[model samples]
Target: MSQIFENLPVKVAELPELTPTDLQPIDKRYLKVLLIMQSIIFTLLTIGGAAIVYFSPDIEPTLLHFAYACAPTLVLWGLSAALTLKGFKKKKYALRERDLLYTKGLIWSVRTSIPFNRIQHAEVKQGPLDRIFKLHSIKIYTAGGSQSDLSIPGLPEETALRIKEFVLGKTAEDGAIE
Candidate 1:
């Protein structure tokens, strides 16, 4: 058994270096929407926390309790705001010869490249918040999973539609469309 393993050749696949492309950034309006949504959520949580602490008979209404309630919310708000700004700058997408690349992240960056032939289908989606701002996201499906192969959010409605059509066109060309 040991001799059989020793005779086998080892092969390691490595990803190639990414070439820079004219990546399109999502609309600036998305930033405002994100900030507003985050603010509302954090504000509601802060209020709820304060109310709970104030009503607890066992917990004295001390400065510590007050600070505990406010400090976390404030800190989270600051961190989230910073991350949102940083992430907005990092979010961009580009179409290559036979693949599409979507790059996003603040701390741990992710760059996904999905080949045209691998794309099973593409769709445009909008939530209430997205509709309020006329923004949309694209979901690209592939063969391996139920979840989307890629979901690029914060795109303008027209841009999202364009991308969807482009991906579908490519799929049809490659004879991959069902």
Candidate 2:
């Protein structure tokens, strides 16, 4: 049997909106983790710069000269730390019955949504820093892609696992997987 294809136009005003207030914030400890990681990177850069200045016979190895050479790195590290702190508040996620949403960014905010049926797999990941802070991240991969469609980080270990299971279950119920 062949049926006629109907193209219907819908009213945009009647659609539901995802309020920012409803979004859940990531773990607070993630900020501390980020700051520590930034400091480690800054220290490495400073060490490398100092080594270059000390090894090079052409350049005079003075405390003032080393500080001058590292000024740019210092400025960059400071800006990054400040932005990380401000941007931490912007990282939030919400799981709806039909889809998952993640919002992030400070100046150029972005929100991404992935429907449950499109989800192929979900997994929980914890890096060395995340383990130290007892934090985990959930990576969701959808159909037509080898990369994860969404990654929500700074969640508690148990929370990340539970979310992953819930997403997988939803996909199964939708007949997205065998």
Candidate 3:
């Protein structure tokens, strides 16, 4: 029998930039919240499952079963958190003259390059918890995504204002991306 293999598309790597990131580290506390929330969900699911399997007599009970069930979530969440944090470490998410690059990811990192010419509008947002944390999210609008608005969380109020001014200025200057 002849062996057959399919070639997969490969993404080329980008060269390291000499510049630095504009924003501060996207506080690891966010990751903590995510992990904690996921673990809580896992716990709740387990509780629900326990309620169902309370009187089951068909399947054998083994530590392996529980481990196998939770292993995928643990591994996936662990890897994802690790990578996202790592990307935060290496790259700076900031706005440039031509594009607004919001880069975040690990092995499969993403840098959404929103050219100023594409900007339609910009906004600043804050929430209850944000007031407590003195943080806000600067939302940028383009015509690409649903509302063309993207929000980056965990920014200080001042920083969010700065981003808004910057985006608005760029939009006025370019006047093409819309």
Q: Regarding lDDT, does 1 or 3 come out ahead?
A: 1
Error of 3 at 135 (Å): 3.1
lDDT of 2 by residue, 1-178 (tens): 0123334365544456677776899999989888999999998997888888989898899988899878888999999999999999999998887889999999899999988888888989988999999999999987776654888989998899889889999888875445
Pairs that clash in candidate 1 = none
Q: What are the root-mean-square deviations of the candidates from the true structure over C-alphas? A: 5.9, 4.9, 9.4
Most accurate candidate by TM-score: 2
Better of 1 and 3 by TM-score: 1
Q: Global lDDT of each model?
A: 0.84, 0.86, 0.63
Give the runs in model 1 whose Cα sits over 4 Å from its true position: 1-19, 62-64, 146-148, 176-178
lDDT of 1 by residue, 114-150 (tens): 8888888899999788899999989988887675488
What TM-score number comes out for model 1? 0.82
lDDT of candidate 3 vs native?
0.63
Task: List candidate 3 segments past 4 Å from native.
Answer: 1-18, 21-24, 55-91, 126-132, 144-149, 176-178
Q: After superposition, how far is residue 15 of candidate 2 from its true place, in Å?
A: 2.9
Higher-lDDT candidate among 1 and 2?
Answer: 2
Question: Per-residue lDDT for 88-157 in model 3, tens only?
Answer: 5544466666667776656676666677777788888876556656667777777866654666776766
Poorest lDDT segment (10 consecutive residues) of candidate 1: 8-17
TM-score of each: 0.82, 0.88, 0.61
